[model samples]
Target chain A: MSGEGWVAVVGTGPAGPEWLTPETAGILEQATDLVGYGPYLDRVAAGHQRRHASDNREELARAGHALDLAAEGAKVAVVSGGDPGVFAMGAAVLEAVDRDTAGRWRDVEVTVHPGVSAMQAAAARLGAPLGADFCAISLSDNLKPLAVVERRVRLAAEAGLVMALYNPASRARPWQLGRVLEVLGEVHPPQTPVIFATAAGRGDQERLTVTTLAEADPARADMRTLVLVGIPATRVLQRPDGTLRVYTPRYYEEAE
Target chain B: MSGEGWVAVVGTGPAGPEWLTPETAGILEQATDLVGYGPYLDRVAAGHQRRHASDNREELARAGHALDLAAEGAKVAVVSGGDPGVFAMGAAVLEAVDRDTAGRWRDVEVTVHPGVSAMQAAAARLGAPLGADFCAISLSDNLKPLAVVERRVRLAAEAGLVMALYNPASRARPWQLGRVLEVLGEVHPPQTPVIFATAAGRGDQERLTVTTLAEADPARADMRTLVLVGIPATRVLQRPDGTLRVYTPRYYEEAE
Candidate 1:
């Protein structure tokens, strides 16, 4: 393994070409190898760079492979969908580096670059529902216990913070979203607004549904969805055309 | 007031030109007026567009002015540092639109474009400290009460969520950061890693400091700084050159 190579973990920011930042594009342009999940790797334009596509659940393996290639003098770019640092490949790459027992990749310079996150994209589509203090929780119980997820949702709701829930539902675990909504219902008011944004930033596939806590159905969400639950200060307004816009007020009325 | 105008609220993503997205740049190119705080408005390249810069504390007025410009048949872009949807100008603009009486600007279309947020930028610099669930809390009590901020911190800390603290301190509110630290100390371990990233994404002014909760000083942070508090799964590693990197592991050991 040589010390001449480096690895950069970058995010494409959802699924649009317009969302890619110049910094990430620069790294992608200079990379000798690109590694990521199949769909995310497909986002980049086909070029001379060697592609290492893998399953979505194989983040650690992919990270280790990228590090090994970088240690062997290959400039590698690990691609992710949203911001690499937020529930993405950046941590997986670092975890691989930490587990490098032989220290072979010590000289391989690793850098993580920022990108727009799913929550940010969803919030933008919904007109700034997360304009105040907000929490991002992954509803997947694969990494943490459901009890912990429930407790965090309840606490965040009680604190009156807007909540952005990612990985709301998967085929394997179908009941997580219902439980989350149940926990949210116990803390927030029935009229609290909820937003379901699916495939945001992915033109043509984007869909947004706005409802309230009492009427928000868990069936409206899937793995591709990002759900936002509002606090008491959140408002829902209707346009003349009957479209609804939701936003959380920057200031609390009673706080003043 | 006319129906032929629109306003796009876009974020510049902390600082630096590379952080600006193509989507935001396209909007900026077509805008007839740019409305935002003086520093944020200064980010755009001066052109034929009219500048409507205001004080940092006057987000609502700035937003209303932007709406007025749009209603008068001008294309306006409201610039914010980092994602406008996240505690920036996006919500303020929506609030102003909602408060518009007599519906003078009813036909004025408003949209928010997502940008890299300060937390995402800071986490990238610190090597993915926000890999899992995280919360963004603005320490400034100008909008909400200090009690509300403190309660949210305690609940978020207790939930084991990595926290990104924004506006940690200001000239007039020096005690909020200390109180946040005191509350965090009660829930998190003393050895928990804390990161201070100032002026992130700004080419020459970016600075990062790594320390533990027990040793972290509130004075090290300012309004331009973003502070990250890690969970038990977070780790700090050193390269052969003695440079440090911090990251929270993607998977919890006990969860499996």
Candidate 2:
């Protein structure tokens, strides 16, 4: 099950088939099997002739199965949104490959394709708000402890860095991001701009209101939502249509 | 020449035709005229049925031409690589439309189709080095002033932030990135990780040796290079093959 096998960890992009890059799309189209989280697997186009193993909690096992299929001379893709290595299945797949096949897996050509991360998608929606110094943290304590998350948040805020919060909250960990906000409040001003971007690039995609840090409601966020907390220098400019765009001035030369 | 017309600023992804998302591809396929920097236009599929205006120095003029074509009832797509808003023509087009067309272009709907930015491409090559806090700055002062660029660099480095420096250096501005390094050296340790990722995703793409801040050679960098400077906490891990990867410790949970 571990001979002549290779795995392509592909990013399905932030949302929808339209956002999928040609390289990623080509890999998916050529794969004989697709393995990923249940929701992410559902996002791949159906034109690809492939079998799929979609399980939310069985990532490790699914990775093993995909490697097995690849060993059988089948092209395999382990799909993840954005870049797989960025808080996704890339490290897991590599670890699984290493453990299952030992150093033998090194001979197999493994390629990790990049995708548009939710942070980038959120920044685009917010008018280059991430153009300044920023940090990204995943608030989910499922893998790590809340204390670690808090420390990073506190450090970033105290250092006047913008932050992008992933996995801010879900059904089971609904208060994780809220706790994070509480910790951040100690270091940042209450008027700091906070952007809630949900389901970025998906059908129900919505860029929620940018409010002051004290006003952000974590309950309104979900697994698909990305929270961006700006530093003191971040500003929200309101448009005539009542929508607001957030940006951190990077101070460019005055236009001649 | 701008009544009831629309413009779509599309991203052509990192490579050839396959990298173009379906939405962007569809827009380009339907466009009567495509406008962008010279190299980007050449990358579009040869069979593309559109007149193209490829000029680097004439971005604003090309954008105006695209708007004129759109006003004449021909759908127009002003294309850029990666996301148009990042450091591309999308913002320029919008700004020009705002200034030149005013109310006349109000009815003109404009949509920005996102693409894979070079930073994401660089991150993928380096194995998620950008997973933590980061900022992006363009060192080219052609359209922007050097003072503005210096301010952002100083702020980002002082915050111990990872930074993605685009347009690092070129034939005429060979010493820009060196000056940036000088500023960064004052704030960050001399041993910080610096990655020079050039021609990412192309056949000739080269992922340079990631070295410490004190050892990086800016002379080897160019406009096509995307330079990543890691923060204090960022560490370069050695793979079995001795290839390096960068990761910022989020410190998840404290080991209880």
Candidate 3:
């Protein structure tokens, strides 16, 4: 097996060590080379693997380097925080492989290793807000236009689907999340449940807040946070002990 | 912690034991009661834990029962085959807890443990169909109306979003998958990439087939299969060794 080339795109899942899956850990252990954003690469156990850590914007370049190494018969692993397929490196790696015109790069074996996505962590933390048909749209207009982003938000709301908004806000684009909230307010009621969970399941830094859309402050969210907006059927309950929980019902109303 | 009422909703991820996460495994090992569909409960290691396995159609009843066990101060674990939050039991449990009205159920603490969702497993197996903006809709009209399913399919295609379709077809509903495929053909080219993966990541009985929209047959998919349809940006590449791969580019196109 060593004679051929292979690359594993692995998701590190939640930030805490315990959240790491055994399958992903085992795949990283066998990696001869690890490539990813610096912090994600650091998550791989320090060993014989040569690390090619880079900045966040270098995903395409990093994927190329991983593919190049794999083509040379090295066992390469491209590490991405959370699930690689969801707004992560899996897409970049596959894009690189798909666009590779040379036969050498095409023959390199590639596989994506599934891990728990950040949305899953947020949903787990704040009860299940995504219990029905849903859509995930990145509010970041870095690649797509903001107009397109705005349209998707409206269309998703019109469809009454629970939505997970990725890249809701960054320091540079603090107003991005507010715009979506405004569109949501037009369609959903003020009491519609919205959850902001930052660095969820990451031990101490994690912060979870369940609130109504009207009460949700975009300033409370940053890059680390994932915002979940529930449909009209979503409900928030305050327990007798003052703790709050939110959930979307599995059944949609129909003619009985 | 032992005296307090608590329940852990665990997602068993893919079909095999090796795909199981350590955290979920540890929680299941400590459970005093296991509740889920019969097949899901069977995945739990048999021991002292009392099993309350039921049929698939009884999700709400099962969730209520799990909460009942937790309210009785038992270490209960409700296992879902995939990520509990994604069209599964996580919402059911939370909804049951929130609407109990008797107030006895609200105090039964619940936590959802994130695991790899079935869509993630399918995306991993077939490169990255979900690398960009995506939506997941259950094609099973058992709960929601079939018209809602058909409308969402058209709208999702109109939005140019990749789609992950769950419960595409069942033995009783053999014609359902065909309907969605027909809608997909209307919006997409006949050569649009489509993937059908059944019992993914399972050691055996796992099947993966990649075909275009025109070539795909609904007969190939069943209840266990997940269908992935790519957007316009998606591509299919044939390697020198003749293996086919499909992926969506991470970079969203800008108006030139």
Candidate 4:
């Protein structure tokens, strides 16, 4: 597909402008219009030559605006932190473009440029917590029913898959992660390795704590937090000086 | 930690030298000794001021050598592709430095700089398969046991977590991922979305077909291939032109 008038869904990496991949930066620089949650657009350095539509509450509207602009033959960039295809705006963009009124927007090229997710950034800091089979689920029931979230948590725990919890808690959903733990407790032991990482890669980044499922306190978590729960085989080794690291034992390595 | 004889663990991003994060590049430029797997060393285009230890095998040996050099006051940079800490030699360096023979190296400072992981690279090209709660498991049983692999696979599948399968198959371990599919079939449906991504960032990069669990052929997979399996909640939407895109339902946004 020709690249002109395309909608580029770009992942800006974890934090800061430097983490943005070259491909993402190039799309942002070349786009005629920019659309995203407000904070993400703010992440781009000043003096980029793109018009902006930044609104956190009206995501669908923003996505529609980007698609409308792209349909009008304007190159647009929908910015996301991490990757657009994950939980970000890539799907929303596609949905907006595919709507009956803007069916022609479908012909406009779409490209997704990936960025590092918070789970990865946190895993990178701690060690290879994600080296083995894992699962990522947001504890918030803002959209899905609590029953569904519980079911996924219980099943994932029973499977002994490492779990990355996104949107664990917000002001309105403060007890979400705690509720997830309550469900997970039914299958996973209390000693499961749990790592809570917040604001990973940002200058104001704080809070990298290693604890067990029983010890995890959702009160300390926030929207910025990314919680990682390891399976039964996962272990947290503490150094003599008190630094803790997490690893999932493959067990096969020892068979040799 | 003063930048003096400290070691910095850097990631080379996807492929191009420009893809390297500035912080990672700066660390390489400032280091007095470079230590990493041989293939990774070749990716760094910038010239380093000091010596380097490069090899195809012997990751642990390279870490020991780097730490020994750092003990003698050499500023070291231990490098890896994507991120040093993901599945790379960063942990090996840490383990080696923490050993008793590394008494001098213990006092040496260490910093881990994050980079793009292969999963992220693949997810970027395909939309956001890695954004939701996903598990990444290396199919290679060299350092891990097949039982552990089966357990994790079962758990991840049962939890309805998306999966990024690494080291899916190699010359000697050709049947590993195929066996993993058999384990997954017990829990997951046969029609789950599976993506095979290869050579993510390079010019020759290719993202192959998305098929169902029942139709997946592990024989076609290799060490360089990154396989992504979508969860039950994931939907593969087909465009009017017959193009398919995979996405997971985040539920919360829909409620809003």
Q: Best candidate per lDDT, number? A: 1
What is the lDDT for A227 in model 2? 89
Better of 3 and 4 by DockQ: 3
Query: lDDT scores for all predictions?
Result: 0.86, 0.69, 0.82, 0.70
Candidate 1 residue-wise lDDT, B124-232, digit = tens = 8869999988898887657777887888899888777889998887566788888888899998878889999999878788889999889999999977899999987
lDDT agreement of model 2 with the native: 0.69
Q: With candidate 4 superimposed using the best TM-score fit, by how many Å does residue A188's alpha carbon deviate from the native? A: 5.0
Cα lDDT, model 4, residue B158: 64
Tens digits of per-residue lDDT, candidate 2, A61-120, equal: 776777777766777888988767566766556556546545544445556778777777
Q: Could you give me the TM-score of model 4 versus the true structure?
A: 0.88
Q: Rank the candidates by lDDT, best first.
A: 1, 3, 4, 2
For candidate 4, the C-alpha RMSD (Å) to the true structure equals 3.6
TM-score of each: 0.96, 0.79, 0.95, 0.88
Q: Each predicted complex: what DockQ?
A: 0.82, 0.29, 0.71, 0.44
lDDT of 4 by residue, A1-256 (tens): 3556768888777778767777677777787777787788888734654757576555567777877777788888888877676677876665555454736566666667776667777876676666455667766435566766787788776656677887787556667778887777767778878888988778766678888889988776788888988777665656544666666543333311
Residue B109 error, candidate 1, Å: 0.4
**Error at B119, model 1, angstroms:** 1.1
| Fraction of the true interface contacts (Cα pairs closer than 8 Å across chains) found in each model | 0.85, 0.28, 0.73, 0.52
Q: For candidate 1, what is the total of clashing residue pairs? A: 0
Candidate 3 local lDDT, A1-256, one digit each (tens)? 2547788998888676556678888888888888888888776657788888889887888889999899888898899998888888888887887667665586788888888888988888877888888888877646676677777778777777789998888545668789889988998888888999999988789999988889999988887899999888887767666766677777665421
